[model samples]
Target: MFNRTENLSLYIKKYPVISVLIGMNLIVYLLGLIPGIGNNLYALGIAYNYSISQGEYWRLITAMFLHGGFLHLLFNMFGLYVFGPELEQLAGKLRFFSIYFISGLLANVATYVVEPLNYASLGASGAIFGIFGAYLALVYHTRKILPQLKQLIIPLVAISVIMTFVQSNINITAHLVGLAVGFILGMFQFTPKRIRRFREK
Candidate 1:
């Protein structure tokens, strides 16, 4: 089953933009290892209490690239590495990029609005979830042609949603909100007309 999916390096070759994004995220992670500089870099994430409300709205976007710790960064980056390339290939570079940034921003916004008094939240999970959502949209949109993908996409989404609920300190709200927003955006990207045109072409 897994062998049916394309290799990551091949996918990146086909979609260079996603490669650059992955590189950028990795670069940011590396920067976060520079001793005091790393600490300062992390401090830039959207802190609901002290930082975000202080007009650091850019953190909504920036925080997507910042991570709390090694494991935190690893998981988010791994998710992006696995899913983002496929999404970019299916949606086209521009549309895929749009979904990632917008969904991530919405995730951060949801976090800020819902937990205005909470401490800082960071990582690319929102954006990664956006890619997952885009994958769902693409698979659903192309269901007639690629009916088999439903088995993969649907189960993955279900598992992710379940994990969101079961995990402690997992920022359930951000995950839910991000997923919701991503699904909405994915729907638009995979509108019937667009899908038909894409398939026809």
Candidate 2:
């Protein structure tokens, strides 16, 4: 029989950065569950165009850790669990952190620019999409080494993007922008020749 706690412990040890990120998101979510705090947290955490224009710049980063509900937290964490550790392992801790935060903040900023003045958004979907996009770039750069990854990863990302249309209260703009940024960053992070040379050294 498998022990869930034990498994989680092992996973945390194996992927310290991802574990810390997940822990941070979960901690913020739990803190936001308190009665008065949730609304206040949202006020600070949600990225609204007007609020940002008024100097609420921190929302760009804070929004990524806030969730509207348990389901939202679960879905985003599931994505992080599935994609984060592997990417962190490949990119190393600093670069992985860069990809996650930079792409997430940029995604929110992009949405702020294009969305309505009253529009507000929060969640980790942008960062998760960035991770997905990075994977696509990794596959592209290493196609010769892992030719089959192209077929598998591309369709997966495409389908997920398509599914976003049927959903409500989701920011597709943020998702796309995050993905684009991640893909662009990945091109540099995982170039085949570069990786191959690193491996050789």
Which candidate has the highest TM-score of all? 2
- Native-referenced Cα lDDT, model 1: 0.76
Off by over 4 Å in 1: 1-11, 196-201
Over 1-201, each residue of candidate 1 has an lDDT whose tens digit, in order, gives 233265767766776876787788788889989999888887765445457777878888888887777788778766776666656655787888888888888888888888756566877788778877776777777788889988888998899989988877787767777777788889888776776666676
lDDT of 2 by residue, 1-201 (tens): 012333787898877888888999999999898899888988877887789989989988898999889999999998888767767767888888888888898999999999988988999888888888898898888777878877878887988798788788789999999999999888888777766765575
Residue pairs clashing in model 1 are none
Which segments of candidate 2 are over 4 A away from where they belong? 1-6, 197-201
lDDT, candidate 1, at 155: 90
Scanning candidate 2 in windows of ten residues, the lowest lDDT window is: 1-10
Q: After superposition, how far is residue 4 of candidate 2 from its true place, in Å?
A: 12
lDDT of 1 at 149: 83
Error of 1 at 19 (Å): 1.3
**TM-score for all models, in order of appearance:** 0.87, 0.91
